[model samples]
Target: MDEEDSQIQKTQLAMTVPTTRVDVLVIGAGQAGLATGYRLAQEGVSFLIVDENQQIGDSWRKRYDSLTLFTPRSLNALPGKVLDGDPDGYPSRDEFADYLANYALHYNLPVQTNFRIASLDIEAEALFWAEGADGSAILARAVVVATGGFQVPVIPEIAGTFSPQVRQLTPETYKGPADVEHGPVVVVGDGASGRDIAFELSAFKSVILSRGRNRRLLPEKLFGISMWKWLKVLGLLRAGPNSPLGRAMRKSDPFPSRERSDRDLEKRGVVLASRLIGANGKRAVFADGSTLDVGAVIWCVGYHDDFTWLMIKAAKDQTGSIVVKDGRSPVPGLFFIGRPWQRNRASALVTGSTADAQRLVDDVEQYLSSTRQGEGSIALVAK
Candidate 1:
């Protein structure tokens, strides 16, 4: 077509994709984002939650099929809805995902699914702009980045040394032992993910789990009461970072084992090895100078925060985590929710999102009010 015809088509396409405007823009629709949206809606705030997933709770649905929440149904409930089943029973990953979807629908949360935010920047003195992957955009007075801290999978540098014949996978991508070759499997890292994977794989094939410092194990039930109930009774779950209990809990790793111990894993045919150091040819080397011949390796190390899309470098810290006090970022109008230890030790948990969102929404409303009152521009300084 001629240049004018092409220009007319471009203009029409642009016109069809309208820019959304709101008082606040939430960048995720997970537990954290939905919690904040619920609070914002209750306060009559005009806000929108934008998620990259095609449907609500797709994030949870993407996890391994056998994954079940460590937290029982009672504590796993979102802000308004309790998971509709035996409160004491654990819910599978798919069940939890469905619960999240139902929660969003029950609350009528304003969420735009399949809209991944590509970049965030200050559009003007008092407004922020969020551009989506689909060419749509949002302008708002405040922004809450509710994307949880764990956005990127973290595999160690040694992973590259493995032989091409050996299959490699991260916990995020691993579905089951069927995804690997028929030979032995080596699971790297001693975290909950590694333990769980090793436990499951042992039933099908010979499994070796690379060990680190062992984490404290809490029994699934004590005296016929769930261990979560004990944590709640001891005030450990709700303790703030400044509290003595919180300080102790933060220094400790997550309780990895529920009802199983090292002995139990050994009894189940899971051999515990020293830390995985590197790969030597086709063999997996360990810190103890030993090696294991394996057909596959699964890295359950952990995840890192992915915030490179954010235009403002001043909003992040040296470690790349968003610099925030209590969900309020160093940038005045910018906020972060669903961050680990953002306010309390429980800040990252599903049950903790409500309290974290409540405090964040309070600060967000205050910031909006100040902007409306012609206050000076928010000081966006890195802490």
Candidate 2:
């Protein structure tokens, strides 16, 4: 998922603030946001793309340095831009970040970076008002929250019970073995990230991967063909979440690691421990009642859905995730993209955003037109 942290204190100011008017306002200039912007530009919409990061693709760069996408370059490209490299080879996090930067530049898209939106609301005037910390605001007819669901790092509540001396790290903060302290490292959550971290740290520290359940390790290739190619040809990627085939996939969304497994980690000297249940001082207790000493712990437990910034109370569900059909939320003129299974299985992948963006922009266009809104215009209003 395209990830970043934009959960901050909401700036409760009036729409009277020096506001920038736009036809469509897209937040988070990540893959999903950029794709949405591209589609909006193609439709001749007066839109703006804003991101909290200093650059267009810092979201990918801010991730772990060892991060390499599971999808090859062939499947990772955004719409109209081919990722330049060995089509079958995976791109490192840095390489993908640079590609996103170049994609924005080549398209000459209007992107505003280092612009953090603290709060958003839809007023009775039929305009979306977004306030920033620096006293700037955006008033738009429609808002596309392209930021994915992965906004806040989610750790178990049991973490607070651990001793203060045990240093903790999330994938957001963890870079490499250098970040780990002396002694064994206990990695919580045996997902792809957890496995990758444990496998990498095994060479330096006595690494333990807490496996929640047995993960299926499909080979990277089948019949001498890349598994992705197989998936595409099998029509698995086109299945929507509501489809019979897609409903089956919703059971487990993580793309099973093709390379790493308990056997692979065991051979790499990684201890395959049971699910982590508790932690006390320097020892991490597992579900099997086994405890192992640890110096540092990494939580690859995943992220929380944080949309508290969107001040539309009725539009949010009990879980705080926006209630949306496809990308359109319960409220008119407010839409979301980049959510897994939002439209289909590929919705989680970067390339998947292209189709979703196109459709969502179409919906946005329809919403704007049906509302009898005039063409986008700019004006200098009194602050």
Candidate 3:
């Protein structure tokens, strides 16, 4: 087609896309999004929650099969619903997923599943636009990005060097040992995920745990009381980021297992190795210059914050993490929720969502009030 004809067709197609308008637009329907939505509802604000997945809690459901929460049911509840089960017992991944789904249903939150946001931009002062993967869009007075901190899986550069016959998978894709070939498996990373998977795989195959640093273990219970209960008594979980206890907690890793130490794992027939450095054909190389012959590799390297689709310059930091001060962005009407240390270390957990959402919704309400009163503007000049 001629250039003039193509231009006209593109213009027509763009005009055909539908646009929605709301007071607030939430970009995810996960625990963070639902928490924010519940608070928004309480404030009598018009809002909607949109998710990329077809189901409300499919994100958790898609995790590796044997996954379970480290936090007990009592501390895993979100907003208005308490997990109805053994208070001291951790819930399986599937059970948590079901709880999230039920939480949305119980609250009757307005959620549009399978609606992935493609781009977010400011159309004008106090006016924001969120374009979806589909042709639809939402124009809002305020935007809450509740997509959580875990957006992209992180695999190291050396993973590509493995032989084609050797299977390599990330925790997000690894279901169980049955998915691995009938041979030894090397699990990389020393985080909770790596240790958990290694523990499960040790029963069937020779498992190697390759890690950089040893984690400090916390007893699941102290004097017959759960560790979470002790943290509550100490007020550590609720401490502000600048507080002394909060600072120390943030510097430390999440509490590890009291029952499983390196020695314990070794006793269980799980070999502990140094950090994985690279791979040579079928051989897995470690930072200690040692090599392990394995049939499969599992990378539990964790995730990164991804906001590439967000077109606002004031929305993200140099590392692509969302920038917010007490949940409010520099741009007047834009906010971020479910970010690690967003307000406190608990900000990313289900138990912490209620407090985080409460504070953030208050900010959103104040921003909306100021904009309505002609106190300030939301126009953010691109940096």
Residue-pair clashes per prediction, in order, are: 0, 0, 0
Q: Which residue runs of candidate 1 sit more than 4 Å off their true CA positions?
A: 1-17, 242-244, 318-320, 374-383
Residue clash pairs of candidate 2 = none
For each candidate, the alpha-carbon lDDT, in order, equals: 0.81, 0.82, 0.83
Error of 2 at 35 (Å): 0.7
- The candidate scoring highest on lDDT is 3
Superior candidate under TM-score, 1 versus 2: 2
> lDDT of candidate 1 vs native?
0.81
CA error at residue 324 for candidate 3, angstroms: 2.6
Give the per-residue Cα lDDT of candidate 1 at 109: 87
lDDT of 2 by residue, 1-383 (tens): 11112221212344345777787899988899999989988988888888999998898888788988888788899999999899888899999999899999999998989988888877556778788867788878889998887787898887886787888999889988899877688898887788888888988999888877555565678787778777778888889998888977766554645567777888999988888888888888999999877788899888887777887776798977679888888898899999878888888788688888889999998998877546444332334
Residue-by-residue lDDT tens digits, candidate 1, 1-383: 85467446544544566677788889999989999999998988888898999999999888777888878888888777778898888889899888888888999888889998888876545577677887777777899999997788798888889888888898889998789775689988877678888888888999998887656777778898888878878777788887787777776655636645677789999998998988965799889999877898988888998888897777987777667787777787999999888887678888788888898899998989978786443332211
Error of 2 at 230 (Å): 1.2
Angstrom error of the Cα, residue 126, model 3: value is 1.6
